[model samples]
Target chain A: MDSKKGMKRREFLKKAGVTAVAASTAFAAPNVHAKTKTYKWKMVTTWPPHFPVLGEGADDLAKWITEMSDGRLKVSVYGAGELVPAMQAFDAVSQGMVEMGHASSYYWAGKSPATQFFSAVPFGMNAQQLNSWIYQGGGQALWDELYAQFNLKPFLSGNTGVQMGGWFNKEIKSLDDIKGLKMRIPGLGGKVIAKAGGTVVLSAGGEVYTNLERGVIDATEWVGPYHDYKMGFYKVAKFYYYPGWHEAGSSTELFVNKSKFESLPADLKAIVESACARANISMLTHFESQNNKYLQKLVNEHHVKLKKFPDDVIEKFRTLSAEVIGEIVEKDPMSKKVYESYSAFKKDITQWAKLSEATFYDMNK
Target chain B: MDSKKGMKRREFLKKAGVTAVAASTAFAAPNVHAKTKTYKWKMVTTWPPHFPVLGEGADDLAKWITEMSDGRLKVSVYGAGELVPAMQAFDAVSQGMVEMGHASSYYWAGKSPATQFFSAVPFGMNAQQLNSWIYQGGGQALWDELYAQFNLKPFLSGNTGVQMGGWFNKEIKSLDDIKGLKMRIPGLGGKVIAKAGGTVVLSAGGEVYTNLERGVIDATEWVGPYHDYKMGFYKVAKFYYYPGWHEAGSSTELFVNKSKFESLPADLKAIVESACARANISMLTHFESQNNKYLQKLVNEHHVKLKKFPDDVIEKFRTLSAEVIGEIVEKDPMSKKVYESYSAFKKDITQWAKLSEATFYDMNK
Candidate 1:
């Protein structure tokens, strides 16, 4: 934990009049002031303090829960490195160090490979399809089963619609172009790069710009056009590739300590769930509304060369992605179980999307 | 109002233990038992009782608000013709007859042509883009301004993704094929069909199947496969078409009476708003998850021939749609203001979609 950031967050929470209250008081008596009892909770996140869209979504989620509960459940949000390191968010929440945590599921892949399926899969469904699967197509059951192992309950909090591939110093014309390329990509996408004879350089968000500028990494995939533009990746790299095959529509999550969550009354529980659902759509729309404006800025004002990965190169990556995912599923039974549901839903929805969304795009064009 | 249905709904409300409470009690004594005061709100919707997806979404919205508020704000939902006719839902809410109303905005086109852009337009943005404009872009402010004229506050409550074109008895291979077509379509789509040399037959949902079976109408446009299959459109119409150009992604709205809404405390207002947002995403996912399975049944078991509208015919419809929208905008200042925002957002987002979503689909395939 970073002490300065932690102290700052503490001061902010104090200023908001949030005090540490006994959790048991909430369940003390059903009729005697139980409804009016205020439960102050802390939420730790994986992004920097109030980082655009992602971190802001966490802030909004906490705010909505607090507002809807009418201060009955006041939540204080701590950014990455505030109360704990970014990577420790899941563990902190699971161990009850914090009441809640917000981050993407792929970040917990080392703990459980099955976690990656909840966030995004290379060549998997995009935001709409992903939401459909999780909310209605039985994906939530598998997710609940997986997270219950860590004593955490998960909710889909936000999504960055279809992302751009990466910022490239050199154009990727074919599979040959991938060889010897040092790129700062993460999760399954990084594994695919490593398999394609490329060097997968691990860099933090703050380090990515410097690494790309210093030629330590030849490319890096951030988020979509809006975040990419905000990161000023166009200034460091020349070409921006399209159709982020590695992360079609990556989902962010809000995980709460199971014991703590179960202890809350039904009203607060409903408030928390509804807030997450609200945050889920709010974040996606936030990105969708601004991505195009920033995309136009990057192309017209910044002169970023926008390009698509070649068909053969995309094909190779797709093949590699499948192989990587297959290896993980084969080793982990839980991964296999989750992947079965995900792949089945994907196969069916892809066909329907072809006739609906895909065809509508063509007609509009 | 249908007295029989109204009596049944009132009985159901009574069975649920909902009673009419004085709204003024919620604001009196900000400190003393104000938090415990219950608000009983009636929501009249333009759908049959517990109708799949749409009506169910309304039900869920009310349920969530009730649960989140800890029964402090209990909402009772009524189906169309229960307290008022389907088309009268807007006036009911506007006139304070009901505290809330649920239906698509385009259903109120007779009230104001500007309402059409908020719901759907011919060749307009789909679910994702429309949500973007409404939630993040400046569309909400315009919507608020327009709905204020009717003494209502509107929220985007649900969406039905991209719909199928229609169930056609005859194939449409060219622009000429649309000539003299009798289609039971409504709103902007119906106007486009009329302009394309088709007779627009205004048939209610219950009458569509009979009218199509008796050859009174050659075509009809309903929702996507899930609802259409349930409606048994495949049995009467041989050719089901792809890419519903007119109603791309229709958005359903939840409107509350301005006076009633303004009377609520901050927590109840937040609860209602968050519930609507939750309902918005819930409905889209519900439709997306089931449409594929039902579509498969329609094509495989039912042996329905799925077809795409011809390029020339789609192009003709697109042109006529623009002309129809043009006339409305030309005559109405509010329509012009709303369309300016809608069209601009649509234009920009379309370009972004071309690179991200559209290209991603191609890569995935």
Candidate 2:
């Protein structure tokens, strides 16, 4: 038995070493007698049709993935709710109902509060920090472990740099006025607000307008200038805010079913991840240009009334978040464990951010 | 006065109307500020010193900004906490104590529940969507409007594509196992976990290893293989997971004081933003190769144990998170307004992510 175990381990190492060599050769496949089989994948996302750079970003990923696989693998993308509702994407991929989908982790908050950890953190690390946690901070392993259970495989697809605060129907004045007010805030901030004695609401992408217009909710938070101006929010909400705390730096993903993912040739898997990574950077460049142009317009053409959150309100929320956060850690073991890890990561990275970005801005400003 | 306003508007329109013409004739400004001002800007980040990819990303931004400005914009970079604590970055920049800082939004939940919206939301848009919202979604307008009060300006800087889950001391069996667990989670996932009856801890990057080893946190999330492996978490944690739910696609930012940013030559501002944009993409590509190379070693050499999260835990979290997510929108009137605008944008653009990426992935996989 001992010999067999030793032999098995040795075999695994030998195969792995061979794989290392093969990989270095840029994915040249070993010759096979039989014809190679082609693969097809179904990818879904919550993004819209080819609208601008972002819409095109998805298309770009598809094009690159297909080409990278040398026509061996083909992917077809579906809009949100086409094969499954936007919210059901996790289940769709997990159940092998779809091959993959593009989304943000925060969207899956309904499944597990721990999921929020995978997306973005409130007052947490931005894209860089989040990336570190995921890439270097041991995030991928934890996420893979969590995802394997559902038969879902997730990959980092893209990122939107630190975001802007949301639009407001009324200007934020102080902590008192915001209490009990209705807003369309999502992610971890919702709980923070709840702790601050404020009410929170949720809705789908298509439904927020009517709700806001009809006074269903008093305020709403979204992304930044480019889309905000496109949506004509200035016409409805005169007061706009900046520096989103909830999202900070938001990330999107392409998730595939675990069984389906493992079934693919290693090269194909690499292709998909690589393609997604490419798209990730492409989206940022697209935003850099588009956001700049739209921002000039919101202020110049729209006659938009912009406002800021009151300092008192900001202070109040910051102070009360602990109550809400404490409950999360206290309520569940997994959450506590995840939280402990996250807190440490944040603390450690926090020291670095202080010197890196802070010093420059302080002096130059 | 109206004529002056009209003249300004006309000037702005001319610039936008024919970008090609502007691009062709826009002469580089003659170096006028002849003193060669050695302006020092504070830079802080969530990344540790010399950490490749993210750390280098931050450094790249500083280098590019300085060189592009002809050294007039000398930026002094400090690692996190070198200036102010990581969690206090927003306040540091907002209060003019620091010129700029790098961080994610969720960390600011303590400051404003609405701050969370600035970054990302669960089931929110991925990098593409987030960028669209920031650029065209009226997100920037709101962001700037909010930041105005804080006397700061934000420019999207670096990004990490999609992230991994985390490093775990043990394997996760099911969602139930998540209960009573300690995790270092951030952003929306932290809140969602609380909703799912789990404990979530906020942590920084540097501290995750010791916490996990010491049993301070059962699991810790950092970045992907390239970084996590470098950080040596595999030595302590046996299991690694995937499918980060917190951050989908995240982007970092270079924060500057409003007056300071405005004081710069338009070209300098443009240079800084553009440089950072390039850095964003560059970092993503760097990480891809870096992570892949190290991942093999983690498994082959380190004998790292890789595991997946149980389906039960993922499903349970998904089911319970709806209630948690719903709470964000209920507070504050403005959040609802922003959500309305964001929804419109999401509805319009989400279809694109599907038809392209979703289709290709589905067929290919």
Q: What is the TM-score of chain A alone in each candidate?
A: 0.92, 0.86
TM-score of chain B of each: 0.91, 0.83
Whole-model lDDT per candidate: 0.88, 0.62
DockQ of each: 0.40, 0.02
Per-residue accuracy of model 2 over A111-161 as CA lDDT, tens digit each: 766767877766556665666677666777777776776778777776665
Model 2: lDDT to the true structure? 0.62
| lDDT per residue (tens digit) for residues B229-299 in model 2 | 87889888888776444554566666777877776655456555555555655565465435545666887
Q: Name the lDDT value of residue A334 in candidate 2.
A: 62
User: How displaced is residue A168 in candidate 1, in Å?
Assistant: 1.4
Candidate 1 Cα misplacement greater than 4 A, ranges: A1-32, B1-32
Structural similarity to truth (TM-score) of each candidate: 0.92, 0.49
Native contact fraction, candidates in order: 0.65, 0.01
Top lDDT: which candidate number? 1
